[model samples]
Target: MSDNKKLSYCFDVDGANFTSAGEASVKVKKRLREAGFDPETIRRVSIAMYEGEINMVIHAGGGKAEVVIEEDRIVIILTDEGPGIADIDQAMQEGFSTAPDNIRSLGFGAGMGLPNMKRYTDEMVIDSRLGKGTKITMTVYV
Candidate 1:
């Protein structure tokens, strides 16, 4: 692919199936590896994408994930139509999770989703509406 070309991938997250939560992220990892992305970049992209994928599964009841491979960076975008985040500020706090007891019992939803996503990426932007949905876009420079 040329530097001027952008390779994009899209996946529909199946929120109804917890077992398939990280499948999209895994695909992203494989794609990055095949594209010859550095290990560190691939790691960052994969982790961030995984966290977002889990969040969508546990909270949003499924969503959409998109990865765009650019010349110098990788961009991951997650969108959901489930109940939107009521408070982005509080949601970003580590360990502050609203996940139900059942989800926590499964060892998921520690509320580190947003924080970790921000930590692993160079830039993170969240666009959400309470009654509408949410859209998160994160970018990692290569």
Candidate 2:
């Protein structure tokens, strides 16, 4: 392949299935490895992406994710058209989750997703509007 330092991948998040929630992140991990990222960097990127992916599937019904690999960092952008987060601060808390009971029953919605995402990424930004949607951008240095 061409030696461009920039690479991108897009994925359509599916809400119909929880088992496949992390598919996009998994693919990203592999791609990052093929692109010669170190194991720690790959792990950090994958963890952040996977958490964002799971959140989208759980709360947004569905969404879209884009992963961009640049010379200095990996950027993950996740957007959804579902109900937006009401309180970003609360959502960012480690023990606060608004997921439905059904979702909680699945052993997820532990309220750690957002916090973990932020912890694993070098930078994270969330733009959301009540009743509109949410767009999360996260970056991890390589």
Candidate 3:
């Protein structure tokens, strides 16, 4: 790939389908591998994006996921129109989860999503509104 070239991808996340939760991240991981990114970089991006995608599905009822591959870093943006996070600080705590019991029974919703996302990425930012939605941008340096 040319030094100036950038690869971008967009996907629609289906919140209603638990089976498809990690689809976007899986696709991203494949793309990163094909693009020759280092395994560690690809791993971090995949994990961070996967956590974000799950959050979008469980909290917002689905949303959009976008990935941008630049020369020095990878960017993952997740946007959802569900109820926004009311307490970002609390949510960042490792075991703090608001996931419903039904979702918990499915083996997810352990409340580690945000914390894991933050832990795996070099940078993470969350923009949320009380009744509107949330937008999370994460970057992993190559």
Candidate 4:
């Protein structure tokens, strides 16, 4: 079913700031909570979005994230103009990471970002082109 209702928010991810990662997701989560969404739903959406935000910062050198909240579901779209994913299959696998060692030192690059985002969301779509960019859209039912 298509949702006629939609809520959209835009955020900028900072690639150079590791500590600033997930800030967007945190804001989204707070808004969702204040809107009276259940804790479980809030957690799921926040976690998935947070991971996507982190990926954009690390692999894509930042990006734009759009969140659409409908009556029955929430849709998150993350777009980046950095290096694209070479192998989506491999990247989707848990424990596989292409992040640099420096990134690993920051507590990321565990290779679970994509996998975790998929696991938490009901639907996930990835559109990527080498040397061009990547777009990830994920959805979760309320």
TM-score of each: 0.96, 0.95, 0.96, 0.95
On residues 1-142, what C-alpha lDDT tens digit does candidate 1 reach at each position?
7677899999999999988889999999998999999999999999999999889988888999999999898999999997899989999999999999888888887888889999999999999998788999999999
For 55-138, candidate 4 gives per-residue lDDT tens digits of: 988888899999888888999999999899999999999999999999899889999999999999999999999999999999
Whichever of 3 and 4 has more lDDT, that candidate is: 3
For residue 98, what is the lDDT in candidate 1?
A: 91
Instruction: Report the Cα lDDT for candidate 1.
Output: 0.92
Considering only N, C-alpha and C atoms within 3 Å, which residue pairs clash in candidate 4?
A: none
What's the CA error at residue 123 for candidate 2, in Å? 0.5
Q: Residue 27 of candidate 2: its Cα lDDT?
A: 94
**In angstroms, how far off is 75's CA in candidate 4?**
0.3
Give the C-alpha lDDT of model 2: 0.92
Task: Give one digit per residue, the lDDT tens place, for model 2 in 5-83.
Answer: 6788999999888999999999999988898889999999999989898998999998999998888889999999989
Superposed model 1: Cα runs more than 4 Å off: none
TM-score-wise, the better of 1 and 4 is 1
State the TM-score for model 4. 0.95
After TM-score superposition, what is the CA distance of residue 29 in candidate 1 from its true location, in Å? 0.4
Clashing pairs in 1: none
